[model samples]
Target: MASRDDALRALEDRDWSGAEVDTSPSRPAMVVQSIRLPEDLARWVEDEAARQGTNPSVVIRGLVERAARPAGRTDVVTVRRTELELALHQAVERAIEPAA
Candidate 1:
């Protein structure tokens, strides 16, 4: 059995008091390369980040993840222009309709 002082010294060396090792993929410290986007796209990314209440990098990461995901497994669906217009019309009609 180890002495109490030795155990205390080991605990002091470990130092697990509220400090995280930060192994998460979303943490900025994990990135090794820097990327520069075109001005227009960068502005759009910032604007979208503001609208979504998150950092621009997070928005960009989400977009990259979405693009990399397997087809037909996404939460968002792509549609034809006519189908989008029809859906928009239906949504507007529903919004204008009075509650029952």
Candidate 2:
């Protein structure tokens, strides 16, 4: 993984030239951890990534971020099994709609 400074500098160079850049000191680095998922869950992550035009790592990261967000945060998500099942069913409809 790239160092935080390198990532920040790359972002600054590519996007923040005219804007005020935060020259503040960097925070402590994030810890890296490995997880072993059940095969079914791993396959679901890969499938969702394919549907969303992203990679499995991105899907897993987004899940972790949402799960870790503090309570009362406006962006916190609550998912229901029924909602997820409906969404999965709808994905099949969506997949065929464009070709019709």
Prediction 1 global C-alpha lDDT = 0.79
What are the clash counts of all predictions, listed in order? 0, 0
**Model 1, range 1-100, lDDT digits (tens) per residue?**
9999999999899858888787768634656456798999999999987765568887888788788998888476566798568658767877898999
Q: What is the C-alpha local distance difference test score of each model?
A: 0.79, 0.81
How does each model score on TM-score? 0.44, 0.45
Weakest lDDT window of 10 consecutive positions for candidate 1: 26-35
Off by over 4 Å in 1: 1-29, 74-100
Best by TM-score: 2
Compare the candidates by lDDT and give the number of the best one: 2
Model 2 lDDT vs. the true structure? 0.81
lDDT (10s digit) by residue, model 2, range 1-100: 9999998888877855567868887765677678899999999999998876668887888899879988778964677798677678777878778764
